[model samples]
Target chain A: MEKKDKIYEGKAKIAKLEVDESPNTAQKYGIMSIPTIVLFKDGESVWQGVGVQQKQTIEAELNKVAS
Target chain B: MSAQYKVVILGTGPAGLTAAIYLARASVVPIVFSGPQPGGQLSTTTEVGNYPGFVEDIQGPELMDRMRKQAERYGTKFIEEEITSVDFSKKPFSLKTSTQTVTADSVIIATGASAKWLGLDSEQKLRGKGVSACATCDGFFFKDKDVVVVGGGDTAMEEATFLTKFAKKVTIIARGSEGNLKASKFMEERAIKDSKISFIYSSEVIEVIGDNKVDSVKIKNNENGKEKVIKIDGLFIAIGHKPNTDFLGDQLELDKGYIKVKDNTKTSVPGIFTGGDVHDWRYRQAVTAAGFGCMAALDVERYLEGIF
Candidate 1:
């Protein structure tokens, strides 16, 4: 999360956690795979993408719900 | 108007990222969609031993991260979106993703393959915990422990045999009538000849029972319709795999379910190329997928040269 672009990181509500750190949260997300990011808009989940993604990719997805 | 790219690559597993790395380096500026499962089968994989180049071992997710970063360093654009539909019927192929419609001069299909699961709720809940699909990736974790490999096909026989290296005992749950297995004679005989392997015919893994990690599986005898639970350290589901090409409709040629390719990575459609497990069924190794990715990227470079 720290490595993300500064502007994107600044505006985003990010929660970076290990699978072991939050087993219950991981279960609720149905994270069959690790390193998945679920984006939320207006307190509702909008999108989720699994695996290693670039900072720009994360920013684009974050922008979709920034309003 | 939809955004247009010189090249659009789908799926971000070894194949997709590998291609991105090459294309980015060549200044193609390819746009890649990470798909629903970004890292493909490898992300869920705990450890990988056979990918080569690494004398020590590496975690699956870490390897994929390195691949993605390498591509990012070279100007490859990535989108963490899944493509819901594609239209290869005309030039500048139209792809409808979850967010926006995009067009590309060239498309690379590296969506890869997904392992088939027993679809049990417990099985889904404990995927990375103790139940796995690849014996090559997670077998070392259960060294000297008892494990069970479920299936009766060639893949099942292969997984069971591979599990024998680490597991003290490898129980094969052949879901068929007694003494009638689905694996080929060679694979079946190999498992039968291995001293560490045992067989339980006419049984299916009804449930993967465990608290945190997989502790055991509930097996149902297909003949008598009775279920029994056995203690084990790990459960390997070797039923089979289905290629992730359903989104393509029929715009491309397919062999069975996998995309068929001829002349290296070139698909039936000239401008569209493919690599990885989406077209390959013989070798599903990570190294092999990466090699295919390299090929697809080179082919894309050459195709772009001819066009632009």
Candidate 2:
């Protein structure tokens, strides 16, 4: 669902997970909330959140990943 | 050296975004890290009527989206990264991501707390459909309806008391005996005084029986080993809330797991401000969080001016 949102652009990718994807993965990540976004670079996580954020801030983080 | 910002605000909830709006308006240009819960607790909610200024109630996610847009319009930079770690011991506080380590003159922690819920599959299935965590936000819609509240704490007692205004009958489902209520004497007394409320002691909600919305709850009596199905229109989970600050444990001062704030929104450490549920255990409303966010940003601006 996130992949289709077009929220992620320019070298950034988004993925969605079902509630049962992993054993208490959401709980482990302290995600007692929904619609969380976890940003990754080279298979490493960079950021995560529960809702939409501004574009420039995301770009700044993406720029760091690109470099 | 990596780039450094004047301020870095964490959590894009109402508190964080409100702070960002203030700082941005002041030309502080805060870089707001949206955290794991960007729009905060409001996003998971279905409708928000208590937020004020909205003559007609609006969807929770839509309200947050509007706030996010408002903050962005004021030049607040929003980041989608989850800050994995931080080193507050340094002058220019260092925050590390999987991709880079960035520094900021000031940091505001608005990572809000999350309400705990029963791990029942049926409960999860019916969330926002008829099952909710906040009674204050959703109770009005359940007017003259039967509702079930889970937990034995002050929050549960309070929620039960609040729900009575709307609910025809309020059932308090405690995992333990009625004597095991963790609520304060005043709250417990208040719950006991409510004629519309009934106690379901030593019981747990095995399942919320409903197709798409909560219509009943299957309960198990822990002591008597008895089972019963009670009809209800809604389920309110008031177990408690855990702040999203385990990542910052002991790195800053905390009062009973909640981040401790000094003057206004100032934390124990200088240049590190906190707001919302992460720093507040009481008054965890959207308006209060926004107020704290504004204070934190103003304090951050003062701290930044002294250094920058």
Q: Write the per-residue lDDT of candidate 2 for residues A1-67, one digit (tens) a residue.
A: 3543464465565556664455266445434334445667777666664334444566666667664
TM-score of 2: 0.64
Give the Å shift of residue B177 in candidate 1.
Answer: 6.4
Per-residue accuracy of model 2 over B127-220 as CA lDDT, tens digit each: 7656888886567657678998999998899899989988999989988776777888899888988999989898988988988567899999
| Clash totals in order | 0, 10
Whole-model lDDT, model 1:
0.86
Model 1 off-target regions past 4 Å? A1-67, B119-149, B153-172, B176-199, B205-236
Interface RMSD of each: 6.8, 10.5
Rate residue B260 of model 2 by lDDT: 85
- Alpha-carbon deviation at B280 in model 1, angstroms: 0.3
